[model samples]
Target: PSTSLLVDSMVKKGLFDRKENPRDRRSLCIRLSEEGESRFQLLYNGMKKRLDSLFGILSDQDQEDFCRIVDTLYTHVYTK
Candidate 1:
């Protein structure tokens, strides 16, 4: 997989801005554009709202327990 190719495609799509690094001309600095940030926020909020609604169906205790279990699993999987 070519990461640079993917980045170039994203730049072409206007989702990312690529700038030359001041200290290293060979390196390019990439960041999400304003339009990309706006789109990402919209998608994040929509997913969060859907998850909140889905979790709303559970009781408070169940939700707490579910969160605890998820946290435990995350810790187990992510910790070195």
Candidate 2:
């Protein structure tokens, strides 16, 4: 129910749409709006470009090691 309220708020804020669920009349499907999609694309592209530039500064082997360390750190923290 709290998620539903959040979804409604997001829709009202123009980030997404609240559509009736086809299989369930009582349920609604939440989807990102066009503006939200554009915003997300911009964010994704910016992050990817930045990451690519950062990785480009490292040697291939260094990048591989960094990825492994990040993976381990993620697992260590998330598994806790």
Candidate 3:
């Protein structure tokens, strides 16, 4: 789905709040609502816990290699 559609859906669900952008009158500022913030924290904590558990099984060198591989992939995908 398009970004606009996703944002609209979130807004409709009261997960996001939009307000007039002071920097740009023509555009609006979009931010997570209180509910969104709470949900995000929960999701973040859960993911962090899972990741910590998974990483705990890896050696220090393995973790370093994994991070390097992830950085390379991110750069490749995000850069033109």
Which lDDT tens digits does candidate 2 get at residues 42-62?
999999999999899999999
- Using lDDT, give the best candidate's number: 3
Off by over 4 Å in 1: none
Q: After best superposition, candidate 1 residue 23: deviation in angstroms?
A: 2.1
The best candidate in terms of TM-score: 1
Question: Candidate 2 or 3, higher lDDT?
Answer: 3
| Tens-digit per-residue lDDT, 1-80, candidate 1 | 59999999999999999999999999989999998898899999999999999999999999999999999999999996
- How many residue pairs clash (N, CA or C atoms closer than 3 angstroms) in each of the candidate models, in the order given? 0, 0, 0
| Weakest lDDT window of 10 consecutive positions for candidate 2 | 4-13
Q: lDDT tens digits, residues 1-80, model 3?
A: 59889999999999999899999999889999999999999999999999999999999999999999999999999997
Task: Report the backbone clash tally of model 1.
Answer: 0
TM-scores for every candidate against the unseen true structure: 0.87, 0.81, 0.78
Clashing pairs in 3: none
Clash pairs, candidate 2, are none
